[model samples]
Target: MIHQIRIDNFKSLVDFEIGLSRFSCLVGLNGAGKSTVLQALDFISQQMRGDIDSWLEQRQWEPRDLGSKLTAKQNVDISVQVETEKHGLIEWSASFNRQSLRCTTEEAFCDGVRLLKVEDAEFWIDRSVKQGSLRDVRSEIMFEYQGSILSQLKRKQIGEPLQALKEVLANIRSLDLLSPEHLRQRTRDSAGHLGLGGQKLSAYLHEQGSEVRQRLLEKLQHAYPQLASIDTRSLRSGWKHLDIAEQFSGKVLSTPARHVNDGLLRLLAVLSQLASDEHFLLFDEIENGINPELVEFLVDALVESEHQVMVTTHSPVILNYLEDEVAKQGVIYLYKNAKGATQSIRLFEIPSLAEKLQFMGPGEAFIDTQLTELATEIQSLSAKGGKDVSAAKR
Candidate 1:
């Protein structure tokens, strides 16, 4: 799982570091760069799959677009250090040159030992030439930066650091489930792991065995008592469509997936993703269309899941619904200063606010502690700066 992340020269993040918990929620006022952070993670997740040049081209991003506009930085650098249970820190960086909009540097390391490091077209791997250390095993790995040099490691017989880094990369997944419309689409594509918008839900859920399907359905039904079961319908073209047994209008109805309410479908999408094998899940606007009352259920599911969930939410009720222990430990507040730079601090680190949470919900505690003033203050010397933010025990 991703233990901590350091982001610099990316979007509105400027230069900031964020720590992660098993499950976390990014709660803050608008324009705090919450969604931008999620976008950056998604970009890296896709880039890790290879074809970095093609990935940037697909989004029509210029060199200037990737770096922080808030500063005149020479490069765009994103580095993540994932901590494994037994092994030590594993790091990755696909740094880009701001002028050329090209990846000038890419590297990965395990326990401070270099696994792969690329500069332009040149790279070094673990020693295989029977000459020197792994860092001395140099090779040419550039295809005009179209993909990662790590892909080459996969093809060759690599060991340790590279294999460990590969597993870490595989665990990173970003989910964008805001589109209820996509979930309702008629798709022929394999319902592999629940895709970005859950568009492939029908295909994926249909392919699961009866036991797995029943287990997930039971969990979903627990949160939404109205739901009886989820099953697939055979369409004329030999394709299957998702349908759910729901008790509505005083009668049980087998509703087509497309016809179901957006809230139900969105929750269903989240459920499928949580049930999958992915370890790291990044979600933007996690409370989009769900009923407010069920917010706790969503929070509960995420916090209890085996996966490490990172999500952004505009809903204070979502934060308020969290239990004291979960709220104090799992919430990370994102705030924007007058100049529009984003900063983050976990609630557990703030003693004053943490104490207030024992008596009030997160929403009330936020207001009472003068955080609102700090966010909008033009020259706040107290509890406003990125790393120096403080509260004098209201």
Candidate 2:
């Protein structure tokens, strides 16, 4: 699991680092850079899977503004430190110049010690040994950077440590709130792991066994009481159509999946993700189109999956449900500093959190912290003018 993450000179996340829990939530007002963090993580993962250029094109990010516009920095840095019960601790990081996104420096470490460092075109791998130790790996390998060294090593099985880091980085999955219409379509691509936008849900559902399918249907029923049944029909055209029944209809009437409520459709997409085998999950704008009443069920869905999950939300109802599942430390509050940089504070890390939680629910506590005064607006530095800006009263 990823124990922590550090992102520098990437969009709004300039020199940002945060500790992670098995389950965590990013709480912030609009434009607080929560999505920026998720994007940075996604960018790095995509770089490992493919290359920087392809990832940028896939995301449709304007290359001119991909790097931190807040500074003249020529490169961006993204890193994650992960620890497993068996493999211990490892850190993987990459630095690529913004202009060409060509690799500048890429490095990995084991237990806080550097294991490999890659510069412009040169690669270095350390195989250090303790004197007279039978487990000596003092030999090292050096290669010119054609692409990511970690990716190269994994493809070649050159080193166990590099392979571990490559595997972890390649496994990162970030699921943004899915598009309803996109979810309704017959998926053109069938991915074992769900895509960043939660497409191919139809294919995913059709591929699951009876037990998992029943569980997914039950989750849908919990969110949409009227949802009686869901099944996929393979047409003569060899395409799949997701069909559903209403609770009152008792399987007599079936509704095409496209007709499902927007909120219900999003919930279905989320449930599909929860049912997956991925070890780590990141979701952006998770509250979009979800029923406020079903917030608790959503919490249960995430918790029951037992994956290392992170989501960003502005919903207090969601927070109230999360309060019971995650400790105070599991909540990270993202706010904008005067410099317009993103800043974070764990709710539990605050000494006075108990006093606030005692008087009100977690949702209310979050609102209380965000308030300057009843009449005054939440403030931030204006990125355009570098002046103080006010947000309307919550």
Candidate 3:
């Protein structure tokens, strides 16, 4: 799971860092750079998959658009710390050159040992370490890779630590752009995971095993008690379609995906992604179309799930539903410093906020307090040119 992230020269985020829990929620006023937090994670995932140029295309951004506008820096840097079952803790950082649209530098370390390092067109990897000494076995690659040299390395050539890091980065999934129109469309692709917008949800369901599908249906029934069963079938055009069987007055009524309500379809999409094999999930504006009661249910489900989940919300109801313990550590507040760069701190760390939480719901406390005032208090408490200790609290 991802433990922490630090980003520099990336849009509104300049020297920004935030720690994450198993289930976290980002809350802040508009333009506080909440969505950019999710985008940073997606940016890292895109870098791992391919070159910077391709990622810019996905976001419809230009080469120069990658850097933070607040500064003249031409390179965007992102660092991630992840905890793996086999490798323990691994820290990886990469620098992307805006002009070249390629990774200028990349480095990774496991247990304080360098696993991979790249500078310019050359790269080095320490294949193994014994007795705290680097082994004589080292591999060198001299070439200019488009995106990440670490990602380009063959799995057979790298050891288990590097492999585990790659897997974690590859599994970082973002659903910040789920579209109802795409969810209603029928597609022929049977992707192992749901597409970013859930466009291939039908195809994805088609690929799930029987046991997995059964588990998904049971979970969905919790939100839609009338949903008797879910079925997917191959169409004549080779596309797959998803249909729902609803029990009505002792009879069954089948409804196609296109006819499903916005809230129900969105809920189904969320549930399906939760059941997927992805390690991390990011949701933006999680309360968009869902009812309050269903939003409560979604929150409960997210907390109960094992995956690392992060969501941004404007709904106070979402906060009110969270248990005190979860809110204490899982809620992160994003704000802007006097320099207009994004800054983050746990909501519980705000002075007197913890005391207020004891008397009021987290939602009420958030609504009553002014985030700007809180941000000012934090800025004064923290020293200049110092590490953000608030981010390290997690």
Candidate 4:
């Protein structure tokens, strides 16, 4: 599991560190750096997958090089610390240059000593010219040219370490970015190992036999009593479909996996991922497209799983479902500071209120209490001549 992440000069993150828990929720308004955190994790995992170049390309690095452009002074420096049950401690750092539009230096450390550094020309050094200039210097450097530590360990026949890393990566899956169209295609294909968008749900289900399928059905039924049975079938045209029978009605209803509601599909995706042997899971916007009534069930299911789950949500409904113990375990609140930089504070760090009032519901209480407090602070500052004047006078 990732114990902490420290980001410097990465997009909006100038310098920030966040500690994690087994089941964590990151809540804040939009554009508050929530998605950036998920993307940062994705970048780390992609680097381990030997796809750092491709990942950098997605960020629009012109020269398509990482080692040549990423530097501590020129670009952003990112340091991540992950704690594992088997391997102990692993740390990774990379420098990204916004001006040069590339990553120049990349390094990985195990238990604090440098294990890998890929800035040499042999790993990556390409020639490229400016728009009208004829000169060319080392344009890009491939950080994972020798493959990731995880991949190298696997190739070396280190089964335990590879398994441990794989479990950690699997748990970092980000499903919220999945698109409806992508989900439809996956349902149509019935592929296994459902990707972020659940495009592989059908395939995964199709690969399973009656026993495993029945087990999944049972698990789903246990979480959702309304679901009588869940089954998968392949058509002659090579399309796969999921059949969901409602408990109240005996009639069996079928929907092309694509036709399923977003909420239902999202819930299934979460459950399927949690059911895997992964040790940690991080979810952004956990409440997106999910029903309020099912939030509690979803939380319960997550709690039952052996893997640690971290979810980011703005919904009090979802927060309410979390047990007090779990809530106190690792809850983080993301807020923008006076300088417009994003920072995180532990939810428990906030003082309990006096004259507590009974809330109609968790959602209501969250808005009336937590959110209201922040809003009131903002209002008070605005009334006192806003941020600019206040700062100038001080």
Candidate 5:
């Protein structure tokens, strides 16, 4: 599970850092860098998966597009801290050259001991005696590697700590901006994971066991009383499709994927993600196409999920459903500073909001406040020695 992230020179996130909980909700206005945070995480996941060039090509982004325009830095840095059962707390960082779109340096540290380091195209793997022991450099120099050094190494060569770190990074799944049209398409029979846009949901649903399918049905029924059942069918062309059955007045109605409502399809995508095998999940605008009454179910399911999840939303109803304890730690507010750099602070850390939280729910306070105006007030109060601004600045 990722406990924290540090992104430097990536879009508007210059020297930015945010701590994460098992479940987090990122709330902010549009263009406030909420989506950019997910993009940064996605970029790191892509780098760890192998070829960075293919990811760039898929997005039609230039190598220089990775860096922020606010800084003249030639390199972009992305780092994450993950807590693993076997390795404890492991911190991994990768530096990429903006012009080449390749990893220039990468390093890992577990509980303060350096386990892996790669610099100047020369890499070293430490086969230390124990988990927190001193670094033992098993050095090697490779000049012709692409993407990340960790991705290029064989599992046989790396120690347990490095192997665990790679696995955690490679397993990140971003389900951002899911489209209903994409979700309705038939996919190959071998598709096991929901495609980033939920395009392969039919094939992935076909592979689930009966227990998991039953759990999904229960979840859907709670929000959608008409939903009777959901199943998959095979196409003659070796593709798979989804069929949903809804009951009304004791009459069963069968519908194909192409005919399902937008809300139902989006809800299915959201619930199916909670049952996925990915260790970390990123969801953007989760409230989109979901009814206000069902927002509670979505928030509750996400909180109870075992996987580490990060969600972004502009809906006040979503915030209203969070429990007080969870809202205190898991709710993050993102805003752009006067310099146009993205800044993040926990929701409770804001002096203006903290005062109101005592008297109201997060959603009530959020709906009643204007963030940019509150930012200006905080700045004025800081100048007058009224409150410590540093707490909210970070």
Candidate 6:
């Protein structure tokens, strides 16, 4: 699990640091930098994959473009400090200039030595000009820009870094911003590979016997009573599909991935990801398109599951269900200041607030206490006249 993240010079995040919990919910209005935080994680993953250049290119800017705009330097530099449960602390930084595309200036520290450095080819340039009576150096270094660190290291028989990168990527999964078609394709694909987003859910089910399938169905039903039973099968020509039988109805309904509603598909996607051995799950707008009553069940499921889940939501129903868990410091609320910088406040840390009151759930207590109009009015009056003004006047 990542205990904390410190971001600097990243897009829309000048300097942001937020402590994370095992199961956290980032709540605020839109453009509050929620998606940007997720994007930072994605940026790290892409960098580890050795697709940093391509990633920047996809952003439609060169290092100089970003650096010139943000830092007023010829090169753009960004750093991410990640504190992990297993790795302790790992700091990764990348810098890019117009002359040099992108360079990995830093990586995981092991035994006082950096594990990796920017390959010369990554900063490939055509020619080097001299200022005075010196000869120009035109030689440059460049590596294959297509493959990730894993692919590059595998070719060189370097396995440790690849394994580490893979582990980190596995721990970070983003299901937000997924298109409808992407969701459907992932559902269909998960039936076979369940890699991520249920990419191979089908293959895993096929490998399991009837007993395993039955046990899984029982567990799913326990988590969601609306689900009667789930059946999966492969077509005669080898296409896999899922059939969901609704409770109280004997009729079995079958449909391809495209026909399922967004809520059900999102649930399945989340469940599939949670079923893995990965420790951390990051969910953006988790309450989107889901039934309100089911939100509690989802929260309860995540709490009971072995993995540590971090979800962002605006639903009061979900917040209410999580109040108890949050009182134990399991929940965090992310908000933006006047300048639009992200800040976090723990619900449990509210002064003069008892655990019992806090556990009454976020809907009636925290949200009402902090965001209600009455509370705001009280605060305004207190600020103007002080707390003793009412008693003294009376």
Model 5, global lDDT = 0.81
Q: Model 5, 332-386: lDDT tens per residue?
A: 8887878888877787767778888999998998898887676576567568987
In angstroms, how far off is 94's CA in candidate 5?
1.8
Q: lDDT of all the models against the reference?
A: 0.70, 0.67, 0.82, 0.57, 0.81, 0.52
Model 2 clash pairs are 127-137, 127-138
Off by more than 4 A, model 4:
52-74, 96-114, 117-171, 179-181, 186-192, 234-239, 247-249, 352-365, 370-394
Q: Give TM per candidate.
A: 0.84, 0.83, 0.93, 0.72, 0.92, 0.68
Superposed Cα deviation of residue 10, candidate 4 (Å): 2.7
CA displacement after TM-score superposition, residue 193 of candidate 6 (Å) = 7.2
Model 3: residues with Cα > 4 Å off, grouped in runs: 51-54, 129-144, 383-394
- 179-200 in candidate 3: lDDT tens per residue? 7897888999755766667788
Per-residue alpha-carbon lDDT of model 6 for 184-295, expressed as tens digits? 5523323222432344445455554456666666756755666666567776656556655665566655555567677776676566566655656767778876788678
Query: What is model 1's C-alpha RMSD?
Result: 4.2
The residue-by-residue lDDT of candidate 4 on 284-364, one tens digit each, is: 787777777777878788776777776778787876776655665555666665555556655544443112213233344
| Candidate that beats the other on lDDT, 1 or 5, i.e. the better one | 5
Q: What is the lDDT of candidate 4?
A: 0.57
Model 2 agreement with the true structure over 1-394: per-residue lDDT tens digits: 7888877777887777788887778877788888887887677666666566666665777666667767778777777788866558887788766665555677777765566776645656654311122123333435443235565555444356666667676777887636787777776445575566656766667767557778878777766667666787666656767777775645457888778777777787778777776667888878887767877888878765767888888777777776533747577767766577776657544445546777677777766674322112223224453743321100
Between candidates 1 and 2, the one scoring higher on TM-score is: 1
Question: In model 1, which runs have C-alpha deviations exceeding 4 angstroms?
Answer: 53-64, 97-102, 127-132, 142-147, 155-157, 233-240, 247-252, 348-352, 367-371, 376-394
Error of 1 at 180 (Å): 1.3
Counting clashing residue pairs in each candidate, in order, gives 3, 2, 0, 14, 0, 12
Please identify which of the two predictions, 1 or 4, would achieve the higher TM-score against the true structure.
Answer: 1
User: Considering summed lDDT, which 10 consecutive residues are worst modelled in model 2?
Assistant: 372-381
Candidates arranged by lDDT, highest first: 3, 5, 1, 2, 4, 6
